[model samples]
Structures are given as C-alpha cells and as structure tokens.
Target: MNKQQKIIIISIVALTALLAWVVLKPVQPSDTATTTTPHEAASEHAHDHSYDHSYDHAQAGDTHDDEDVVTLSDAQAASAGIVLDMVKPAHIFTMLTLPGEIRFNQDRTAHIVPRVDGIVEAVTVDLGQQVKKGQVLAVLASTGVSELRSDALAAQKRLSMAKTIYAREKELWEDKISAEQDYLQAQQDLQEAEIAAQNTTQKLHALGAGTSAKGGLNRYELRAPFDGMIVERHLSLGESVQANANVMTLADLSSVWAEIVVSAKDLGTVKVGSSVTVKASAFESQSSGVVSYVGSLLGEQTRTATARVTLPNPDLAWRPGLFVNVEIVAGEANVPMAVTTEALQTVEDREVVFVQTAEGFRAMPVKTGRSDGKMVEIVEGLQAGAAYVTKGSFTLKSELGKSAAEHTH
Candidate 1:
C-alpha cells in the first residue's frame, strides 16, 4: 500500500474505535443529575433560607399598640362617609313606640240625612266640597213636607178666625149682651183651634220646611249642621230617598284621631291626658297630641285595646288612613355625656366608639347607661368634648378587624 493510503486507514480506524468506546461507557447517576457548581449551590441554599428577621420579630410581638387603630386620610374619611361629632350632655327619653293610624274624629263627623221622605230636586253640594254651617246642601220635593206645610197653613187660618171669634165672645160676655152658655161655647172652640194651630206649625218646622213655602210648597232645603267637607253622597237629582237613609256624610276635618292598639301589657302605660308625639310614615311630619280615649274592652280577635289621641289637624295635613308611629315618652333622663346610638359598635365583646385621634381613629371601649334607640348615655370610658364617629362607624370597625387578622397571620 501507498504511504498516504496507509495513513488514511489508520485515522479512520482510530475515529471508529473512539466512537465505540463512548457508546459502551455506563451512565452514572451523577451524569443524570442537574449540574450546579459550589457557588451556584450556595446561592440556592441562601435563597431558600432567606427571610425577614425584622418581620419575624414583628410577628412575635403581634399585639401592636395601634392594633385597634384605623388610619385614614381626610379625603379617605370623607369618601367613606365617616362623620364625626362631639360628645356632649343631652337628654334621653325612654319611649314606647306603637303603630297607629289616623282616623276621622267621630265627634266632629256626622251622617247627614233628609229628615223627611223626598225626591231630590236640586243638589248644591257634592263629594269633597267644603260647606259652611247652615248652608243649603240640597233641595228635595216631598209630598210629606207639603202635607205638613198645608196643615200649618190651614191651622194659621183657623187660628186667625178663632182669635176674632174669641175677641167678640169675650166682649159679648163682658157686655152681658149674649147668653153665658153661648160665650163659653165660643171660648172653648177658640181654645181648641189655638192648640191645633200650634201643633201643626211645630211639626212643619221640625221637618226643616220652615213656616212658609214661597214658590213650591213641597220644596225642602237640607242645610248643613256644621262647617265641614262632604265625604260621601248617595242622593242625586230625581233620586228618591227615605227619611232615615244616609244620604250624605259630612266630616269636620279640623281635628283628627290617631288610633293606636295597646296590648294588655301596655294598658298601664297609656292613660287619658298623657301627651304623645306622632310621626307619619307616609311623609315627614310630626305632631303632638293628648290621649283622649281608651277602649275598656279588648278586641275578640286581636286581644288588644283601642286607644285614641286627639290631634288638631289644621290645614288638613293629618289625613285619615295615614300610618303613624306614636312615641309615648314613658321616661326621660339627663346625661352629662352621650353619643348617637349608631356610633356604638360591638367589637370583641366590647361596646366601642371610634374616637378621633391624631393618627386617624381608635376603637374606644365605653360603659353605656340609658339608651333610647336614638342616643346612648356614655357613663364611662369616654369624656365629653371628645370627637367620635357618629355615622359610618361600621367602616372603622371593619378596618380594625382586618388589622387584627394581618397581625395574626
């Protein structure tokens, strides 16, 4: 072989043997493992062990002084609707709130009726129309009224004739120009006519037909008995109504009754002449009234007694059927320091108020006295002139809870 050919063969064999040796070598566990140098390994160990020693120390002392404190800026407080008010001396009332409804005052209300049977001829007043006392309400044509008026007229004629006859008889008796028996008979006749005339005239007057009918004898004018509003009407033109029929209803709304239900237990709380404050549920209105009536017997179904408070309804503001709350001032107290009821919160079994501080607010524990559902008397743990949250105190309570949880974690 040539020298060049010999060298080529030797090189090819060396390369093939080297590849075979590598394929035959065994794989050790160290080869399968991920490679990391001593520096890289130290870096990893340090990373896994790294932690905030200061945070660990802080967590050990979890009960921080500001733990119950909620920090917020002025803008944040305003946005969250956090309202603050000063604690001050105030009066607290112990009240009993009972549901009630406004009703028409029965004493001032009347059911108007045509006194005699009649056919309606003219209706001057209508439903909801205001009327004055003695104003004509309606006109009716009644044959009954006409008969009474006719009897009255006939009685008047007879009375005139009897007067003349009696005068002549009296003169004759005095002059001794007539027999005594004849004069006595004329006097008896005159006396009987006078009695009949008086009776018929009164009967006509009782029917509200008056002493005389100018144009129509059957015409009857029904007049209002008081100044009021017509609440109901049943008679119309050409309608026939009976004497006792409830043809109309008039109500004097100058006064109204606030009727309340009192349970058996509360009967002792309410009494006649006790003053109460009434608040309307349908509108923002408040009024004061005195208890006027209390039913003696309880209702069969409800087992409650009905009580009434009289309220003067000037301007017709206290309308009938409006739901109301009658707040009876059962007791009152004057406290040196008080806060609104909403300012109090139950936190960790403690009654607390979020008192304003230079660093936001802190939940201040309080000892409370009398509470009237509106304001509570802070007997201890808070001083007057200190500002505290009045509204939106719940938000401060939540923030305090969160702070506690974070410290625990």
Candidate 2:
C-alpha cells in the first residue's frame, strides 16, 4: 500500500473506534422515577381566592403524583388517629350569636341593709367571704334597741309589784275583810301594769332584739338571711349607718345570669325558655343555659333589649363581668352537603378539607356556610357523597406542611 493511503486508513480506523466507544459504553443506571413533593403539589394546586369552585377547577381523569398526596393505609390511618366520613345532607341550626356578659343572678342576689340604726362595733365577715345562713355578719350597738329593752324591764317590775297587791286584795275580798270597791280598784291597777309590760316586750321582739342582751342592752348582731358570698362591704368599724342604708351585697354564685344584648329585630327569636349556648370570649370554655328573661322594652338610646340566660355554675367558672357570646338557635336548615366544623382547615389562606382518594388524601379547597358549631354547610367545591377526613384532619394538615417544608429544603 502507498504511504498516503495507509495514513488515511489509520485515521479513519481511529475515528470509527471513537464513535463506537461513545455509542456502546456501559450506561450507569440513572434515577428513572419522578417524584412530586407536597410543596410543589400545593403550589400547583393553588387557585384563585373565590369560595365558589368545583374540584379546584381540575379536569376529570387527572392523576395526582403519589408523593404529592397524603397516603395512609387503613392500619396506618388508624394508628395516626385519622377518621373518615362521607359528605352528605345534614341538619344544621341557624344560630343567632349575640354579645353578652356574665352577671349575678338577681333572683339569688341580695342588697343587705341593717334594719335598725346602729354603730358598727365589730365587722366579722370580709368581702368575698362565703357565709352560711344565719351567720353573723357584724356586731352593732344601738340605743334604740337598748331603750326598748329598758322599757320592757321597767314594765316587768311594775307587773310583779302589782301582782303582789292584787293577790292580797283578792284574798281580802274573798274573806270579806275589805270593801268590794277597794278590791276592784287594786285589780284595775294590776291590769294596767300587765298591759304596759306586754307592750314593751313586743317592741323588743320587733327590733330583732332579745328581751335582754349579754354584753349590753344595746348590743346587736347583724346576720345573713341566706347562704351566699359577700360581694361588697360598705360599712367599716365604728361607722354609723341609717336604718335603711345598704351595708353590703351578698350573691349566691352557684348560678349566674348571662345577660345578652339583643337588637329589636332579634327579639322575636329570643323567647323565654329557649335553649342557649354560652361561649367565653377570652378562653376556651362553653356552657348551656335557658332563656330566663327577655325584656319587652328596648333601650331608648341603643334600640336593644336585654335578654338573660340562667346558667348553672357548679364549678364557679363563670364570673360576673366576663364577656361571652350567646348562641341562640332560631331555626333549622337541611343542607345538601355538610361536614363537621372540626374537619374544616385553612390552607394558603383558603378553607380546605382533606378528601379521600384512591392514591391517598388531597387537601381540597371549599366554600362553607352556616355552621352551627357542630356541622358546617358545604356551599361550594365539594360534591355530595365524597368521603373526607373529619376528626383528625389537623394531622393531615401537619403532614402536608412537612411535605411542603421538604420541598423547600
């Protein structure tokens, strides 16, 4: 072969070998599977803020990435405390929520007044003290009570003296040792003394005073009429009070009144004996009560009427002046589709419920209406007969959040 021909052949042979090596080299296995993290999935699912939509506007036959879905087996779901239920028609209540306040039950509250004028000698009970019926609240010294007792004592003395004279006169008359007129005169005197004594004793009784006092005739003890807590104390040591002046306030706190502010338009729905639910404004506490009162006259300025619900406070959790929300059921509604209030959760600032799917559960955005605190009406986004997570939806939410974080990382 010629030198030029050989050189060309060798170059061609090297080029061909290089091309073969590039084409036939062993292929290292590349990652074949594609995965969607929850974060990416949620971003893809994000939609307009409208509450009216069906299935997030996704078309039928759309398949979701398994990684994007929240998958839990029956055993796994049970272990994670997840519960599922089908969305269906349910009966819901139309609740009228109104602002209210906890207050002392007036029927069981008392404005204490010392019935007689007196100087406070000893104050036994303090504010907020629990007192039993007939417990002495304070001690007082009253000249009026003393005067009544003194008058009673003098009358008794006269009666004793008259009795001695009348007995002798009667005996003398029976023996015919004295004139009938003299005996009759003695008897008249005795009757006058007895009447005077009885009058003074009755006056003492009227004063709630014993005929005699142990410390002094003026000594008096003010007592409670019923079991209650002393809410207010207006009198101090040595303070003199009038007969009718209010000295203290006692309230039976075993029960309380929830006073509701109802506008004129709401009066018709707030009837006496209607059931009510009271929720605390500042804390997570709720109670049940009945409509004990509804005012007929509205406030001239506010155009609102006062309504009351009597609630039993066995634990004494409800206190006067606590703000509360009073929920009164005005009517009922049967919605085509409803889910539990607890099932609803917020995602991307939109309300969503975890819906069950063959792959797993998907957080589906929904529009809701008219919740009675138990069942909430599904207005849009969710179709009837679809199964969704109810009790443990919060757990599913956490899972979604973690998936989103993983994608972020």
Candidate 3:
C-alpha cells in the first residue's frame, strides 16, 4: 500500500481504459476513400459485354441451321462457271438395248451343190472371191453329162436325116415315082425319126447340156446362180464329188442380218416390223433396220428368244460374226417435267439434283423415271420450269459437303 503499488495500479487502469475506448469507438467515414482502378473497371465491363454477346451469338447460331443457304458473290459464281437450266416437258423414250451378233442373211445365202456326180476338173473361184451371176465357178467331167450330150448329138444328126427323107418322100409321092404305100411308109419313118430326135433333145435340155460343137461331151460348167461372194469352197482339182453334195457356199453380201438374242422378258416388246438401231462394237458406225422376225419359242439352252433384223450392207461394214448392240425403242412417253441426265447425282444414297435458289443452290432429292439417255423423266420432287443446275452441279455438292462438316464440328 505504498507509492509503488499505487503507480502500478494507475498504469493498469489507464491501459484498460485505452483498450475499452478502442473497442467501443464508432466507425467513422474514412478520410482516404476506397476507389477502384481503371484496369479493374474495364475488366468488369468486358465480362458483362462478353455475356451479352454470347447470348446474341447463341440466338444467331439457331438461324444458321434453319437457313442452309450458301452465298457466292457474282465473281465467284462466274469463276465456277455454273450452268443453269430450266425443267421442261420432253419425250422420254424407254429403250431396251440388247447384245447381238452379225450374221449372213440366210434368205439370200446359197449352198451350191452339183446335181450330178462328177470329178471337179477345175475351180475358177477361191474362197471370199466375188463373182457375178452366170460366172462359171468350176468345170466338172461327168459321164452322165457326156451321155446326155451324145444323145443330143445323135438326135441332131437323125433330125437332119429325117428332114431329107421327108422332102424326098413328098417329092416322090408328088411325081408318082414310088408307089403310094411305099411313099407313105417313108413318110411314117421320117415322122418317127423326128419324134425320137425331139425326145432326145428335150432330155439333153433338161440336163443343162447342149450339143455344142466346141467342148468335149463330158464337160459340165458349174455357174453362179446369182451375184455373190464364195464364202466356202469344198471343191478341188480332180476331186470326185457326189451328187447333191454342197461344193460351195455363196452369199449375197449386199444384205446382212443382225441376230439379236432377246431375253424372254422383252418378248412382248420386241416385235416384227419394229425399227431398231444397231451399233457396231468394232467401229463407230450405226445402222437402222426393221425387226424382220421374232421367234415364238425361246431356245432351250439360251433361254432367250431370237429376233432378227435385216440390214443392207452396201459397204460390207456389217461383216459376219461382228458383235453389235441393238437398241430397240420399246415405247415412248410424254412427261410433264424432265431434266438433263447430267443434272442427276447420288448424295447420301439419295438421287439428288441441284435446284437453283435465290441465295444459292440446294441439293434437292428427286425420283426419276424413264430415261432416253439424253433426257430423264422426273417423277417427283421437281416442278416444270424450275431452274436446275445441269453441268456444274457437282460444285454445289462439294460446297454442301463443306457446310455439313462445319456444322458437325
């Protein structure tokens, strides 16, 4: 309870009062105010702007999907060289093309046979040699021809004698130099001789032999019946050939036949007298012909019917055994809308044609029908007079592919 104790107590009391004043003091407004920096203010403003812009872009992205529009400037379009066409009505013919073979016209072809058995003395023509009608193809030595010609010669001599006897008998009868019975007998003999001679002459004529004074009796000439080419020759010098044996095959190559192997399904369409176009495979020449024949029965092995078309082969271009394609016009159809075949394309396993739009081109799905190789009938998804891309539609397809890829990403 001294002065030191009182000093310590005063210090403690002062400290406690100071702490209490600090704890109990009211919070007054700061003299140095809290202020934001320019960089911080800019950062907050940028965040708000980014949020609003993202929302606006999200709204715009939805429009992009609904409008699958491709925009190309005039310069770009010109550079791409896009070709546009308008759909129109056209005649689209359904055609059936069949494979065929060129063959000889059997109607004008001949298998020459010797009528009488003989040895082939000479063959004047070779295979593939062209000859005119009445041209001798070969000379044959035949005993039968010889006998016929001998008979004709004897008949000629007898006929001359008969004429002499008939004149003498008539003169005798008129002058009364011989008895009436004797003259009548001579007249009868002359008549009988004349009849026998005529009979022999007719036999020779039937055998195509004559009493020619120049050649030997056994000589027989084989001549061409018509102007034709010798496609086959089985005759040789001094070779014996039997009667009715085919010695030569002559063909009048002025005309040929297109043997078309038509499937059974096409039997109803391919008819006789219908026109068809035949295209040769070896060359670029095409010929038109009429279907001359259509077999009623199908071949057992081939399961196809045979149809024939006769074509004139003046130039001999339609050679036998040459392969050909015959396009028969089955029928024709008039369609309301048609487009060029070049405009058609396959996209996503769908047949599509690029239809022109105000903004750009759109790949429009379509259903196609009869096609005549040049024009195609549009069955669905297109209207007449609508603009479509014909030549350069592939470019638009590529552009569409790029857009789809971007959307997928």
Best by TM-score: 2
Regions more than 4 Å wrong, model 1 = 1-86, 339-375, 379-381, 387-409
Q: TM-score, each model? A: 0.69, 0.74, 0.63
| Candidate 2: residue 121 lDDT (0-100) | 99
Off by over 4 Å in 3: 1-87, 171-210, 300-303, 339-368, 378-409
Tens digits of per-residue lDDT for model 2 on 314-400?
Answer: 888999999999999989989999999999999779799999988799888899998899999999989999999998998888888
**What C-alpha lDDT does candidate 1 achieve relative to the native structure?**
0.90
**Candidate achieving the largest lDDT:** 1
Deviation in Å, model 2, residue 250 alpha carbon: 0.9
What is the C-alpha lDDT profile of model 3 across 1-409, one tens digit per residue?
A: 9999999999999999999999998866673355678998899899999999999999888766434455667787678777889999998888899999999999999998888889988999999999999898998898988887777778778778877877887898899897788778777877887888888778766655566735788888888889989999998999999878999999999999999998999998899999899999888999999999999988899899999999999989899999999999888989899999989988778898888787677778899999977899999989889998898777767777788788778
TM-score of 3: 0.63
Candidate 3, residue 95: Cα displacement in angstroms equals 2.2
Over all chains combined, what TM-score does candidate 1 have?
Answer: 0.69
- lDDT of all the models against the reference? 0.90, 0.89, 0.86
Ranking by lDDT: 1, 2, 3
